[model samples]
Target: MQRIAVLTSGGDSPGMNAAIRAVVRKAIYHGLEVIGIKRGYSGFIEADMWPMDLSSVGDIIHRGGTILRTARSEEFKTSEGRKKAYLNVQRFGIQGLVVVGGDGSFRGAEIFNSEYNLPVIGVPGTIDNDITGTEYTIGFETATNTVLDAINKIRDTATSHERTFILEVMGRESGCIALMAGLAGGAESILIPELRYSIDEVCEKLIRGYKRGKLHSIIIVAEGAGRGLDIGKQISEKTGLETKVTILGHLQRGGSPTAFDRNLASRMGSKAVEALMEGYRKHMVGIVADKIVISPLDAAFKGKRTIDLEIYNLANILSI
Candidate 1:
């Protein structure tokens, strides 16, 4: 490929900077010009782009979020908006494009390619880890680590006061974050949307733990399960325990990426560049079984990525 452009779209994810760096450097190494599209398809349509060099990404690997920035474009969902973006692509002579984000971003890439016959590649960069065909997305490790850190600090207070704490973590649909963080943080009860949850049963567990000489209790509630305020009220009313709720909202979305995330982003980013150079398009790079694989771009959204119920069950058994 003579030239390619990259953009980060949808929600900003940690480790996105690392991925951007890899894409820029990898493209430059292959003697291809790299362009950064600011604000995703919004910028793509507006022609807000500039050429990038190796030094453009030199110091971004350790940073969180995206250097190119990100924004959800309602206009881009329309055909007219995409046509404008296609015109800009031709205007700049960009032969290929790389998109980093969730399935929504991939869907956009798929549509753009279908309309204009442009080459596009997708790199999964969501913290939700809900994209199909990939075991883990770019920002999941950092987000899970962020949640674990919050719960660790909450545990200290829960123990000091011998009170029950209900921690609500971000996971609007997928419970991967809740399940992973709850299991690792030694939570007493974890309520996720995927599995059936019983508030009465949750309270019973707390009461039973109390009877068994466990004074401190931590119940992790995924946002998808119920609002933390409501769940805390239900549990407190049932067990008569002084319960408090702590919602780790946007905090989970920001942080310096962990080593796993950095490495994964680096690998995915480099692969995206290589894929374009190797005549691949309308596909996404996925890491399955520790090996990088390519799949149709729409594969990320064709089905839902489910959590391992066995892990949830094991977490319950160990917590009890």
Candidate 2:
């Protein structure tokens, strides 16, 4: 491929800038021209793109979010919109494409490629970490760390008041963040959508911890599982314990990416460029067992990334 374009779509996630930087610099290093598409497929449809160079991505490795920006394009769902995007692709003489985002973004790229015959590679970049092909998405570690830090601070207050704190973390269809943060933060209870949870059982666990002379209890709830405020009210009514709810909305989506995230983004980003260079189309670069693996982009959306039941059980077992 002589020239390629890259874009980030869907929700903004930490470490996306790192991924973008990697894609730009790696492409330039390989003597290939790079184009930055602003606002994802919307930009592609509108032809809102510009050439990128090494300096174009300077000092963005530690930054959060994408320099190229992202958006959900309702217009892009239409055949007319894809036709417009294809026109731009032809206009720019773009030979390959790199897409960084979650499942929805991958699905769009997959469709766009099939219709236009453009070589496309995907790099997973969602905080939800729900993409099936990857073991961990770009921003998952940073978001989990963000939640863990909040839990640590909340623990101090919960202990001081001897109260139950219900922390709601972002995870609409997945519980990776809540489960990981809850387990690492030593939460007394974790409620996730993937696993059916009973408020009564949650209350029982809290009451048992209190009877055992525990000064405080931390309960982590994925938003998909339940609303923190409702869960808190129910726990207070059932257990007669003072409860506080902290909804960490959007907070988990912003931050300087953690080292693990930066490294993962860099590796995945470079792999995406390499994939295109190797003439792989409609594929995604993912990490498994700390090694980079490429899979068909369809694989990312065809299945679901299930929560680790072993980790869930371990968290429950250790909470006691």
CA shift of 260, model 1, Å: 0.4
**Please, what is the TM-score per model?**
0.98, 0.99
Supply the TM-score for candidate 2: 0.99
Question: After superposing candidate 2, which stretches have Cα over 4 Å from the reference?
Answer: none
* Model 2 lDDT tens row, 1-320: 88999999999999999999999989988999999999999999999999998889999999888899889999999999999999999899999999999999999999999998899999999999998878999999999999999999999999999999999999787999999999999999999999899999889888888998999999999999988999999999999999999999999999999999999999999999999999898899999999999999999999988988999999999998
- Give a tens-digit lDDT track for model 1, residues 1-320: 79999999998889999999999999888899999999999999999999999889988888998889899999999999998998999899999999999999999999999988889999999998999988999999999999999888988998899999999988778898999999999999999998898898899999999998987999888899889999999888888999999999988889899999999999999999999988997999989999988898999999888889899999999998
**Clash pairs detected, candidate 2:** none
Error of 2 at 299 (Å): 0.5
Q: Tell me how far the alpha carbon of residue 209 in candidate 2 is from the true structure, in angstroms, after superposition.
A: 1.1
Residue 89's lDDT in candidate 1:
90
